[model samples]
Target: MMDVPSIKDFQWKTLAPLPSRRVYCSLVEAGGQVYAIGGCDDNGVPMDCFEVYSPEANQWNSLPPMPTARAGVAVATLGKRIMVIGGVGANQTPLKIVEMYNIDEGKWKKRNSLREASMGISVTAKDYRIYAAGGMGGDLRPHNYMQHYDMLKDIWVSLATMPTPRYAATSFLRGTKIYVLGGRQSKYAVNAFEVFDIETRSWTKFPNIPSKRAFSSFVCAENNIFSLGGLRQGRLYRQPKFMKNVDVFDIEQGGWMKIERSFFLKKRRADFISGYLKGRIVVAGGLGNQPTVLESAEAFHPGKNKWESLPPMPTPRCACSNIVVKNCLLAVGGVNQGLSDAVEALCVSDS
Candidate 1:
């Protein structure tokens, strides 16, 4: 029999931060550029601004702001265009408005609104379609809504609703299957995981996470799913309350395992951004219960099951979104004190 090596064998490096600070925003890659869109500030003020980062230049440039400012929106890319979906605004109102940005034209256009307003949802694009799932709606209630947007038709249609209603969950696609993991219900954090088969138009439950959690970030890399840091029960802002544990699930095996290596992040995170890069899972800024926001970054190598530190973002934030474009990771607006205008970049090394 062969033996597996420990996670400590991997290496990592830090990169420059974004130009501004933001939280709860959406990020997507289009036309080889990373776009960061709407999110809130530390004070919970929502924003409408957007920005883009070019890995070749290692710089950020401003873009047309969203027609309506919002936080917790979901952003996905369809060819050279980007779609921004449901979220909440400064008034704490849920929104159903959907917008699209044309990278070549540098203009924004309105699209069909979502069936319902929601915030703290996750979105992914696959096979010319965008899937949005599980978020809180108006009245601050979580919903099980599962919807899809067709890029070619610029329309939306509802699919099967999630079995469990949740908020602040993460969603991604692996092959033809879409998966949603970890978030909060009305009562407590949930570790529930579900998968949707686009071809069959059905939903199925997978093995639940070992621990219940919310505001955690998830990424799919090399056919594996990784769930990272978020808050656990305890006094607000207290130390040892944040979780550094990393959980991995194998879609082929239908099994889950916890990575023994420690993330070594300074704090536990919630409402952070994460994405797959260069065969690794990269995580960015988020907030802790001290209720403090963080700017640090980390990379996890699934093959090694270990975490390595990366360059900290210029602006510390929480509730933000991250996207990969041409080997670069773009972090968009998130909460700092109020809704932020920050846009940062992480240049993934070729090595």
Candidate 2:
């Protein structure tokens, strides 16, 4: 018996599409700019295209193509350089190659590769070092091994292994700790949550995510971590169901709290792009019911504990790389029908 709140005023706007269509691209926001890295083309072939977009100039500028053509890459921004790690390669094989692009140099330089080939790696950058974690290897089993890349030493130092093995997990840095949340293990979706403390150099187990789901997008805002919509795997021969369940992990409360059902997302989906904007959790573009791709978008206001509908994206697609810029949520290349060159941003304003 609660009422939903309105967004007040918000809108979706189209930006310069990628020079070419791509999917599974790696996206990140650094210094108020958004970067879209390697992905696959319309033919499902891996691509080497690299590009950057500026919201102020409202144009995309090209960057040197990566040394390797791959998709599903783990990308992180370290200062002025962008690091691209493990991904599926051109020959349809998992790769351990690592490369870094220096914004000043305007070119990419090969770095120390991973010790083992992997895909679906979860990565985060902190204190000028990259922490690379859980992903699927050639054996097809998720690896719990966690490693940190030392930019100065030009090597990867093995750290504490994850308590749970999985791929496609979401990671974010708060203070000196990196929190890794829900992913998939084989056919089952993982709901485990854990954190790694850099100063202590150890892993601590947190409460297992109550909702058994994977590929759910999570973001940090207002000192609370929010895990949004994803898919729950079902019985054999049955389709995996999309979920609108929203769980807020209050760092202060030290436990997970479920938001009201009325505050759930407007649509059920997984593998969608999400970001925190102006105190709202914004989710857009992903897989939904009837074997369909969704363009529908929505947001949740934690203060009001209410849901607001957002203007749908121009192209409905899954696996789109996403990041939050200064005042906008940018959704980069993803697949809709086929590969999409579309680049769009969900705009937020104080007015």
Candidate 3:
């Protein structure tokens, strides 16, 4: 392991805040602008607040809200169109409503909805098609789903179901395959690691994640998948604890890295914002072992196999909707004390 940097590695910058506070909102980048979709308000009620931030002007302008109000929705950007998939609605129940916002047209249009209503769906856009995987349904059970939106027909076609049913899983589209990692079945975390080949239209079961923890982050860096810190479930003899354990899955080798060769994060975190940045695995604010939310940040330098300290977040919060745009990682609305309107970005510093 390399020594901790004496100088700062990453820097934080405060950006123009959102129009209003939001939690569980879907943040996506399209046409070089970041769009914030539906999310819950202070009372935990879903809102149909649609807004976009123009980096050029550093201003946020409101767009027409969605026809339905919902939160925890899966959003994908295709050219000028943004597809908002299944999510929790006003009644605090899962919904099948599917809507697309055409930026060029500046209007929301209804699309063929999902066959089953669910939330926490993992969605990705490739070519012109959208692939939506596992999600939790109204019954609160995770579904072994695998479906793709048929853009030409304006309909959803079911494909091979995943071997392990889960919700809120992280997915990465590599070449023609979609690698889906851990998600939750209910309150319990699912360790299933599976992949779907677009060409073959089938699912292949890979090795399950070595560590089974809730609220863990599964991120893709170069050719490897890293499962970072989370809340480790305890047995009857012990209490639940936060974790800093890190596990790496080597794609070329088709297996996990040796446990002895794996490393650990600098801090134990859960429900944090993480992303692959400038050849490093970066993690920001989240709930740690303490009662208060954490503001610390760190980055794992793969070449050195070491985690170096970085700048802390301007507004410390958890469960923030995060996305990597250009060279910056934007952490949008989250629960800071209460609902927070803070919009901050972790940037690559020249110094």
Candidate 4:
């Protein structure tokens, strides 16, 4: 087991705020840079704006805007370039336009688009290819389409369709498999767990998540997938509910086990950023406790099997895009009372 650090080991700091106040944007890491792609501006209009953050200089530089103005864009880092895929466009329509930005050239290039306009799509890059899976389409239906864009061919090829159609689902690449976890079919949530084998181009259904979530976050830490806080409906038109459930999925074992409540989050927060920092699983900034966007943050040490209170964020926001860079967990633009341009990071030392 790794030595657990005291709460003092974690430090939260604010970086240069994003130039455009937006939410549902695509934020990703590539070539030692963090790129903020298209998302909706404060007025709820889709934006074509794009920018990047350089930790070395503590500054942000504007890249050329994407060709299509859209929000909720799904983005993936492909080597030095970025693939900007389907998203919600202006007029609240799902977009099928796909574009790529060459960081070195500072220009956008077109790629073969998806057959259907998709929103809430989750995309990830591995082995020089991009995998796009479950999302809501313009038809307002959850799509099970699983496709991959082969860089060499500049084409999108369909793979085995997901058995469960859902949107707002998240996929995490583990070895040759991609695990697609909990998402929503509509107002109702789905707890389905499925994995796509990249080598065989097939799908495998695993144990469903103990708690169904749509906008929730499940982060990887300690060689396990920790399904964190989420929001769901209550019975009989009751108010929506927030969850503090801590479900642990052992990657090697292939099953989920709900942990004790003592280890649950300090607050019931959903749509937050959770990631492994050093050896601790750090969660920060999301919607919690009515009328209060959360700034409070906490860390869970696997070795101790307990939670540790940490410093809160400088700003309160939810749906903030996150990507790990070096030893920092970067929280990008999200909604805070309105659209937010705030950018912050939680840094943990090697000690």
Candidate 3 versus the native: TM-score? 0.96
> What number of backbone clashes does candidate 4 have, counting pairs of residues 3 or more apart or in separate chains?
0
Model 4 earns a TM-score of 0.96
Q: What digit string (tens of lDDT, one per residue) describes model 2 on residues 135-162?
A: 9998889999899999999999999899
The sequence of per-residue lDDT tens digits that candidate 3 reaches over residues 51-120 is 9998878889999999999999999987889999999999999999999999999999999989999999
lDDT of 3: 0.90
Global lDDT for candidate 4? Answer: 0.85
Model 3 segments beyond 4 Å from truth? Answer: 1-9, 259-262
User: Candidates' lDDT values, in order?
Assistant: 0.73, 0.85, 0.90, 0.85
What number of backbone clashes does candidate 1 have, counting pairs of residues 3 or more apart or in separate chains? 26
Query: Alpha carbon lDDT of residue 239, candidate 2?
Result: 74
Where model 4 places Cα greater than 4 Å from the true spot, the runs are none
Q: Which model, 1 or 4, shows the larger TM-score?
A: 4
Per residue, candidate 4 scores C-alpha lDDT tens digits across 171-263 of 899889898888888667789889999999999999988877656788877578888888876768677878787889988787786578777
